[model samples]
Target: MTIVVVFIIVLIPAGMVFFFHHQNKLKLRARLMREAVRNHEFTFHLPVKGLFYGEKALQEALNDLGQDINKLVAQKEVESWQKLTRVLTHEIMNVSTPIQSISQAYLEHPKVVGTSLEKGVRAINDAAGNLVTFVDSYRKLTQLQEPVISTLRLKDFLEGIMELYHNITWEIGIPADTVLDTDGSLLRQVIVNIIKNAAEAGAKNIECTWRDSALRISNDGTPIPAEVRRDIFIPFYTTKSTGTGIGLALSRQIMTMLGGLLELSEKADAGYHATFILKFEQ
Candidate 1:
């Protein structure tokens, strides 16, 4: 009986020690996982204590944690974008309204129909037209609606877009059989904004091509400065004297909403190239 009692005592303590050690290991693993998430590494790890709770329960916990982190990051990004858009829209509209009203008034004045007044009216018209255009562009950036998707022939759609900028010289290289599923209006706007930027940059030769689900537009104009290129998609960031700087921003937002992406690259020669990748729906 004494031997049995001693054996029981030894076994009990050993079991307790093992239990605590296992728990300590689990705690350490959980800590490591949290650290990895904080560092933006999304690698998944099995919970050390998972065996106690069952694999399904442990997986659920990890999934919930991951979702929470993603939601926080996404919320922060959206908040920042909203703030920037609001500030830009407010500043642009302030300038646009006065210019439009004054221009209309000058043009409508009976006494100002002829003489130097006509010249003044014309000048005001030009300024107001530019302001109106800027305001329109800014609105596009700040107020994006959910895209309406449809299947479209890539060649036909691109050809139509090219027609709008027919005055500008262009060289297009795209497969005639390429087809894409996307929002037609939004895609057109993206094309127009990029083409307009190329024209404004004094592009004498604009080249467009499509491959690997991406459409690339290259313009042989002055290269975009590295510093400016970084912030090109930012709302109200512009290099032009008359630019409202919302065109590229709007285009980026549209593409993002459509589950696509827009990127800018520089050529070794001269000028900039903009690429838009349309992700295929799974």
Candidate 2:
């Protein structure tokens, strides 16, 4: 009877205290997480351990949620840019076409041929023609063909591009059996554009590296300055003397459409190489 009295007097109260302490700990953890999310502190990573299994599961779920949110944000941004480009190109073409047609007609009119204004009209006509070409290029930029995805051997693709520049020295690092899923024709255009740029830049050696679902094409030319690098992927931004400046921009857009990524990384070592990185989906 005395032992039973002790059990009710001591162990019962201790058990209640322990249960309340655990509940308080879990409540504190949940409150902290709510605060972090409200403050937009997405970098928060939960500890791997806790007093209960539910806490560990919550940590994993939070980690995955962060990753998913990041991907969704990136995808939305790309879609927004593409939509803007389409609208801009469409409106520009509509305005430029009429000007081009009118200028040409004025230049060819028999009565205007011998007038003092003839030379001025001819100049206007030439400018309008240039505008037409620029508009057409923008049209192409905004309306890229949907890629037909297929499995392709990387080495074979690189070899074909190399053949086009026989005089340019190139070292291909991809193995013969290395393969990836991509649209051969579209990807070929992207790679060709990069190689062409390298050749035009007077690069002596071009190195291609492939690993872990990424391909890096590096050229031993001039190292792009930090300021210029920021604008390289922007449409109509180019440092070249005579270039449309949309090649890299279009290529990046295409890669995004294919659920991949394309970017430029510079090497500032002795070689001063400019590298274009292409990342494919796993």
Instruction: Give the top-scoring candidate (lDDT).
Output: 2
| Clash tally, candidates in order | 0, 0
List lDDT for all candidates, in order: 0.70, 0.77
The residue pairs in collision within model 2 are none
Q: For candidate 1, what is the TM-score?
A: 0.54
Q: Which segments of model 1 are wrong by more than 4 Å?
A: 1-79, 87-137, 266-282
Candidate 2 off by > 4 Å: 1-77, 266-272
* Tens-digit lDDT track of model 1 for 181-275: 89899888888888888788776777777754567777766677766765887777888897777787777777667765565643332344443
Candidate 1 versus truth, CA RMSD in Å, comes to 10.5
